[model samples]
Target: MTDTHPELDDLVLPFSVEPLEARGRITRLGPLVDRILERHAYPPQVARLVGEMVVLAVLLGTSLKFEGRFQLQTRTDGAVDMLVVDFEAPDRVRAYARFDAERLGELAADASPAALLGRGHLALTIDQGSDMSRYQGIVALEGQSIEDAAHQYFLQSEQIPTRIRIAVGETLAGARHTWRAGGVMVQFLPSSPERQRQADLPPGDAPEGATAHVVDEDDAWVEARSLVETVEDHELLDPTLTSETLLYRLFHERGVRVFEAQTVIERCRCSRERIVGMLRQFSPEERRSMVGDDGRIGITCEFCSTHYQVEPAEVGVED
Candidate 1:
């Protein structure tokens, strides 16, 4: 019933690996996440923060296996009130970020992650088809920066060792004209080769079928970590720096192997079916409470800020 996403053709970031048993990847998210976040008319700084989150979602999502999608969300009582970025493939990647406008202004002047998010929780939820149950990992937002928080999430939840560097700001149009939101993520593959030597197992004990899988994962991760380390934050946030350019800047001397790039898009998951399903959850009394004398209920999607107005007729059991 759904048509192919048109924006899939637009994602064109480059991925590569190096001689030091490592690899590097970079994504230029302008054609994807930025489109959705900017549609909300976000201020420059706010857009940048959201943009970083969106790109981060894509980076993490690409590294995951999912029949559905990955949802990364952060809720804080800081300048950034709520942020959600969804990475869906077969081309349905999208994201949205919201913050208190007044607080964002202060953040623009000078704000710390603590000042922005307060003591909040960052959650990563994975949603696949009904055949699959959703899994979520929650961690406290105690780090000085978002990157640190993400690194913590990978270590504590997914148990992946990762390194992330993110920078958000206006896109560079000219020397002074700005028109972008920037972000970058560098991650180490999960489960080190050394860790596979679990203590419980016999000395030099290798499972019948698990040795190669573990070794491959460890090799890939080690190489990825090394290649990614050569990158600098300046190279990452430079709007002029294409994905290939950024990698080249990092490892021009080493031959970097590449994988096909998956496209990311600004697709919202809203639908009449989804909306109706949620509306059906409200008991008659709760419906009455939300609806005013005008006999209408107004609901808005906090992610995309899309407003929906439901008349009384739209509710209740239909004949």
Candidate 2:
């Protein structure tokens, strides 16, 4: 029996996710990458991986039900390094994945996560709401790809079967430094034999009811795994090719439903007021030293690289 619930459609670029099937959705994750790329000029490898994290943050954060933060963190001491992407209310996101900034352009697609990150662990942190305790799940890295790492997280933490395909690459360059990052994720919902009423499940190359079979008394899991396993590296990484078109082309006959989309925007969330507040923490002498001859202070936001100049006198210092 298929899920008869209202379905979502395939979402477009810049933070959108639409339902492509009753139980699945195809997301075109770009514009979000382009925004991040505008702030950076990393190598092909690093840029792609960073995009993957940004997309993953969206897919993993949709159900952040309460008014708090849902954080995805990966800590490592490897060459490529630690990566963290977090999503807050109203679908706001902030991401940073540190690497060999100096040696970035030298990396290749075949580079292993181990070679990039050295050693690491992936974690998901969620702040449900006020007073409620925060929830976090820790999962070990399994492959050189972020998709593989996330798959492991779903199994270990959420105990659900999931398939994740990610593509990271640049579509434009130089004065046109526009790049795109996109991904698709599908998960199986819990089902019971008593509820088995065929809702016309798609005719996937995977075995019939393979998802249910893999866990229970079904044998179709073998077929389903085979279908998902066929997703190719080239297909996932292609920019001109959108996710909806690809998924529809592959499974249209099986009744894949694509739905409405959303947009992902970029925000630094840094303000002069915030920076000024930080400066106040300094002692009188420290503040005086910072003021210099012109009595102006310079502070730069780490994420967006925006610089701010403030006058000491305007702030009104109190001894």
Candidate 3:
């Protein structure tokens, strides 16, 4: 039966399947994604890539138990060279993409993410304020989709069995079309250590004919992954479907329990004070050189496209 629950957006729904020994998160973005894309006006293909990164950021960022920042960044050799998404825990997000417009236009309409991104590395970073240490993980992106890169990060860096599905597209609302994104991530976390055992990484200098060690897959995790694989792209981005309805469709048989949904918003960290402080660091001559014809220093934020006009004297620059 279809869930008639009210459709909501811009929130992460945490859930668990106890019987399957798996837990996961579900997120759907509406205005939150639209605002981010519309502000920058990225090309369609580039916008799609940005959308994917935003969803992935939300999936990983919301897991932080303390106040912190989670950042996802990519530096590549493809048409779309760089992309960044920042999520501030309890609930704020902002994202932007940098691409070679001419190069992006030359690509075919059906270009895959691997084609758009070319070769580079994806980095995920977590910062628990200045007093604490930061953690970061990097994965090479050699002709792979963002989803594929994520899977590799877990297998190599996290050493956990994980599955992820992300979807992004435009939905018609009245006469206008706006961007929307949805993603689901599942990770196996069994109580028994034996159930979480995975094969050891191959040695860098193994004998040419040596036998490789192997580990059997856990039955419960296999079933859980198969279920997540069955989710369709349309189902995820459908405007009428609530996250609750989607989770039910995926794990109703084994039973899924959803916790309180955490709301997410599109908020930029840039502020007038922050901008002023940064400007003060430049040398007096350098600060004077930034003044425009209007007699004020003009600055624009790359993430939110907010323009700032500063007086020459504001940052200790002489007229």
Candidate 4:
């Protein structure tokens, strides 16, 4: 059941279960998650949350039809204030987190997402291109985990019945520690125009003594959700289980079919040229305010922590 392709460390598989009338996405991030996390020396709890965000971003971003970028961001009042992850089209992703070191240290290792993020809104942004309008969806962070928040997002925003299961942790390989994350998302798709029309129709419109058409689809949805709920975290994070094998194990009885998988890698879009272009837009006063005692302007990318320094002369400014 393993795919013939070699690099399965960071890949996503799009799948469908015909009998269940559902479509889903599965993602595994091994080396990619490790590479992204190694750039920053975050605490274990913080790192775990960040890893979950990375996996969640891939699962949600791959579901979109946009051509540019998909970003998942959270701003809260808890120990961890902000978590941001960006997924660019094809297969590139980068993530970063901001937290109060002292506060984070005080929390237990098994703190829930709600305990870590507190009161905040989870926002998803889709940037199609410079020419196309951007789209965003915001939802309250009411769940104990990122998966719960995401499920709520789909339920409220797209009116889609979705189930998400994610697991992130580190595994010891010999003497070295590696980060790994895997997630599965299943969404019930409307099967026909009649179903869609029934869903859109007011409840009162149902014929006398006739059951609502959606009740039938609701039963299917409930069954699919029940199956998804049976997925264990270990099954998702097990390195030995191929994506196909895992899907088969879960939905073999339901006739699951998978499409070609997409490979993902850790990538940051930050560059000196882009940074310089951005700085050039600032007025002379604004630019001067950014210069440090070293007589140069330095900017660091929050995602990759790559530092960029620009001399005043480079932007036609005299110190």
Candidate 5:
């Protein structure tokens, strides 16, 4: 919270407001974001949207209590067909997007999220590893932006009151231009035992222990939501503002507490070994069908652009 590592560019700070009984996460991405976007060389509009997804993924991933990987994916039928953000436990993140370059270039500079990705759903998946089954939750993409969609997912799937604000853009430093992103998320903690029981139950189902249950529209929740609304895009994207300082300015009256910051970096898990393992799944004849005129099987990782080449003998193909 104090910016202990000034050299670090991307990081997430987890915090809470004890008096309000709420927890939240704050994230900022600077050089790391630039590296990710530059690798893909996406159009301006697509880059901004992808940056928002990356920030949101880090915020939500860091808040989880899992040991494996967390992924946020969007599938649509607009100019951009797919956006994927992957967060590996402790501190690694990478993202990529697939879009029609010519169509994206034709769109206005200030295109809305819905206009860029039309008629689809946002899905959040958590992989706890081979021993455990994965969990996934999905919601319709019915918001003005990615933040709004995430808010709807929590309310609909988890029955939680959530607030999210995200900002992504390019900033000029000296002669170089780079991408930066920042976001803050807050969720209310239920006060009543009945409400807590209801949270665990599926939507529309009655809680076993709760005889009477009502939606929470308390003054505290309203006040907290109001305070979050005051946050502006500049404040979130400002490089000068530290996470602790920002939290103090936002909720000093209600009392805010900060936790240790987790460092985030650009990392890709693609390798020749993993690619070879995937190729082994196909039979010898099937593998031969994928060979190019160059007499080698080639694969390129979309996230990092790493290329892998395999020989005919590698997949048990006879000469």
Candidate 6:
């Protein structure tokens, strides 16, 4: 399929290669990522990690068919210890990172994700709002990129044959350079149960001579996985390359078909009214304690850095 639309950014395009019984989505983020990172003013490596998180969140979040939220968070012992990226269903995303500046400064400039994140847990949560139950899956982060952690999530939780490739970098336009990110995720979804069979994980406790259960991978999935693995980092991050063209390059032989693309924007769900409501939940004394020397309570949103000030009296406190 050819994309006639002009080069666009921050959109998720879903596609399928029927011949291989595979389905997947590709996301390209330019201004959306730049806006998120600039708001935080993160260092080079920290910004790159946040950018990668945004790309991964979009790849998984766009898969939701309902109005919900998909959040990717990490708590680790590495220099860049914590990352939080939120994708509200349909098209809004926001992200932030917390790190120890001194620790990060001690690492090599080209530190790997494993090196930056150290050892911790990565969590993916799906929130369906107040009426439904929230679902969360967590996997250990033992020296792996966000891509590797995602693969682990699916392997341990979903049991699906999945492949994910993500890229993040700076692209120069005129004299200014800006952050850009892109990712592609492909999964094998065969119709027949036999074709979907996978080897069972080894038993933790068993006879010493017992062999582990093993099953051969489906050939169609193997072909699809190989093609996806062949994708290079540049292809995903190139500003001039439309996602359609990239997908074509990867699976043109297998005949890929694309669905209508979903657009994503950098937006935070914070507002003065929401902040005020949260303040009201606090006791009058607690709300009063938040007042600054100016005699007004102050709050700043972590995601967007928007500041809100409220008079103590407004929340049932006598100023």
TM-score of each: 0.76, 0.72, 0.96, 0.90, 0.90, 0.96
lDDT of 6 by residue, 32-63 (tens): 99999988899999999999999999999999
Give one digit per residue, the lDDT tens place, for model 1 in 1-319.
Answer: 3332333223545454434444334565554554575567776656666776776776677766546788888887777878787877555666677678776766645556667777788888888878888999887986456777887787666554566666555544436433344454555432345632312323356666654333334555555566565666566555545666566666577665556876656777886667767987989777777776666777887666778887756777332
lDDT of 1: 0.63
Candidate 4: clashing pairs of residues: none
Q: Which lDDT tens digits does candidate 4 get at residues 1-319?
A: 6323336769999999877778999998888998888789888788889999999999877767756899999999999999999999868899999999889888888888888999988999999998999999998885467888887777667877789989988877659988889999998886764442224445576677885545445666777788888989888777777889888988888789999988888999999999988999999889888889999999999999999999987876785
The candidate with the higher lDDT, 1 or 5, is 5
Order by lDDT, highest first: 3, 6, 4, 5, 1, 2
Local distance difference test scores for all models: 0.63, 0.62, 0.92, 0.85, 0.84, 0.91
Question: In candidate 4, how many Å is residue 147 off?
Answer: 0.9
Pick by lDDT: which candidate is best? 3
**Ten residues in sequence with the least summed lDDT for candidate 5:** 193-202
Query: How does model 6 score by TM-score?
Result: 0.96
Candidate 6, clashing residue pairs?
A: none
Pairs in steric clash, model 5: none
Task: Evaluate residue 107 in candidate 4 and report its C-alpha lDDT on the 0 to 100 scale.
Answer: 85
Q: Residue pairs in steric clash, candidate 1? A: 21-223, 22-223, 22-224, 23-223, 23-224, 171-179, 171-180
Off by over 4 Å in 6: 1-7
In angstroms, the error of model 3 at 57 is 0.4
- Kindly report which residue stretches of model 4 are placed more than 4 angstroms away from their true locations once superposed: 1-6, 193-217
Give the TM-score (vs. native) of candidate 5.
Answer: 0.90
lDDT of 5 by residue, 62-85 (tens): 877868999999998888979999
